[model samples]
Target chain A: MPLKLFELVGRDAARPFSPYCWRTRMALAHKGLSADTIPWRFTEKSVLVPYGSERVPVMLDGDRAVVDSWAIANHLEDAYPDRQSLFGGAGGRAMARFINSWGDIAILGGISPLVLADIPKLLDQVDADYFRTSREARFGKPLEEVMATRDQAVIGFRRSLEPLRQTLKAQPFIGGDAPDYADYIVFGGFQWARVVSPFKLLEETDSVYAWRERLLDAFDGLARKSPGFPV
Target chain B: MPLKLFELVGRDAARPFSPYCWRTRMALAHKGLSADTIPWRFTEKSVLVPYGSERVPVMLDGDRAVVDSWAIANHLEDAYPDRQSLFGGAGGRAMARFINSWGDIAILGGISPLVLADIPKLLDQVDADYFRTSREARFGKPLEEVMATRDQAVIGFRRSLEPLRQTLKAQPFIGGDAPDYADYIVFGGFQWARVVSPFKLLEETDSVYAWRERLLDAFDGLARKSPGFPV
Candidate 1:
């Protein structure tokens, strides 16, 4: 049987928006593997309970279930070693973990405030309520209020990406000449922003903007074909 | 002849303290290769003129001259394929470049202000004058003035290390189970700071501190044996 992946979505099942899920999606595409997507939503924890996860990007490859995007990427790499390697070698795999941490802390965390307020608008009432209540508790304010200073906050976000920007200036992708798991790790956050929010996270002249354009066009435009804004 | 490396020092030749040179030092040790250190001081630019570069860590591997820490690493990896790998593989080699950039910008840059004032004290009168004039010009302020707010500024430096700190919490080293070039890349900055300053860059409780401790003990205390303050 083909692999099946639980991907986070909202009111529109066609739009899979979770940053972690996009990482797995791109990883699968990179390996030339296809997974049937099971659209998940914010309030759908019960759906993943049997899979031993309360998160999206949980993959079912036959009877074995892999939870978390990072785990799923590892599972895919180990299970299909004959396919193109996700990490070039042991070294790449280890360093990619650093990249993954940077992706979570720097890229995803940086983009969250800019896009948080726009997320609930695309969710169903129940999911929207769940998102707002949970997120507000985390931020100690309403989502919109958290995002009120996003215009000014984005300058810091851009500055936080200096390492990434500098790297991309010297190479075509984070993985160097070819897109690898490292590139997918960061691009997942950008793709998530594009899917849900129209906010301008990057200027067109930025090298990062150009790198994203290349990844968007990668794998026969697999990411582009997925529903997302022009960002 | 055995390999030779020109490493930056201040007054005491025993305390070679350029962050880039430390990176090459650790990389050589990782590859089980040793180079005789040619101590280069701040005012000794003429010594490197024949090497086609004005930088320390210009490695002389027999008849060949390899310049830059990154280039020296690549040279070692390529020249001694029979030895242990500096980068795990091609994928790792590519990703290490990103880590290298992060080390320079985040680790070295962040630590500069916190330890800048202490650096000149480690140098001789001639080198100290040159160092202060050059660094002050770069900062557009006196070295002491640039570091005046470092007591409070260190907070931001610690916060900037969140990604590296987070990675160390999950793994023993940035290179994962063992130290690799990626580990050396960031550790070079920490080692540089430790070599010149008594400033407390990492709290005793920080995971990064533990990671540094392990590295300090790596290669049979190669870095620790070198003259440095007890950071």
Candidate 2:
């Protein structure tokens, strides 16, 4: 049996919109591995409970189940050593931990408010209600209110990507010459925003925009083929 | 004959506190290569003009002059391949470009406001005048004003370090298990602050603070032995 991955989607099972899940998807492709997608949704907590995870990107390889995207990436790298490395090497694997954190805090955290309101439109009624309720409880506001100032907020978000911008300017990718898990970790956030919302997270003039175009075309247009708003 | 490094120093000359210079210093020590320190000051631009650059971290190895800390690091890595690797490997080296950028923007840029006011105290009158004028011209404000709200500004600065904090929390160093050029890139900023100012940049409870302490104690307390305020 092929490996199986629980990927978070919404009304359209074909669209895996979770940033964390996209990270796993890219990692699997990078490692030349394929997994049957088990489309997940916000209200699908019961299915994940059996996998001992409350999240998408739960990768089931044989008898072992990996819960987190980071864990899944590691598992893919270690298990498929003969395949292309997700992290270039041990050092990259180490530093990628920082990149993963940056993706979560700077990318995912930064882009959340910019697109959260649009996400409900992609979800079924039950999932949409669950998402709005959970997110509102967490943020103490409605999703639309949370993302109300996204136009202005996006300027700051673009500025926050300066480090990534500078790095991309001098090199083709964060992985240097080629894309790696560091690139995937960050690109996953962009993919999430693209798939669920029509927001323009990156400007056309940005080196980040160019890098994103490269990634969108990476792995035989794997990410581009997935259902998403035009970046 | 040992290698020679043009390091930025203040009036005392013993304190080399330029963040970029400190990066070269740490990289040298990591490579287990020693260099005779040639103290340079802000007004010493003419000397560096002959070096083809106006940077303090102008490293002279044999007859060739390597300017810029990043260039010097790459030179050392390629030149001394037999010694300790500054970047773990090719991937580590590549990802480090991003870390280098984060160090510049988030580390050096964030800490500037907190410590810029105090830097004049450590510089000679000539250097101080040059420093203030150039920086004021750049920022379009008096140095004190630039740094006036540091107490409140530091809260945001600390929060901005979430990525580094998260990275250190999971691993001993960005290089993992041991320190590397990536560690030096970030630590150089702290060393610069420690040498030039008395302000506390990290809280005792912070993982970043602990990581700084470990780095300070690395290479036989190399950074600790330098003239600096208690971290």
Best by DockQ: 2
Chain B alone, candidate 2, TM-score of: 0.98
lDDT of 1 at B136: 94
**Which stretches of model 1 miss by more than 4 angstroms?**
none
lDDT of 1 by residue, B79-158 (tens): 99998888899889989989988998999999999899999998999999999999999999999999999989999989
Per-residue C-alpha lDDT of model 1 across residues A1-231, encoded as one tens digit per residue: 999999999999999999999999999999999999999998889998998888888999999999999889999999999999889999999889899999999999999999999999999999999999999999999999999999999999999888888888778988889999999999999999999999999989988899999999999999999998998
Q: Native-vs-model 2 lDDT?
A: 0.92
Docking class of 2: high
Q: What is the TM-score of each candidate against the true structure?
A: 0.99, 0.98
- Could you tell me which 10 consecutive residues in candidate 1 chain A have the lowest summed lDDT? A167-176
Which lDDT value does model 2 have at B204? 97
Residue B50, candidate 1: C-alpha displacement in angstroms: 1.6
CA lDDT, candidate 1, residue A165: 83
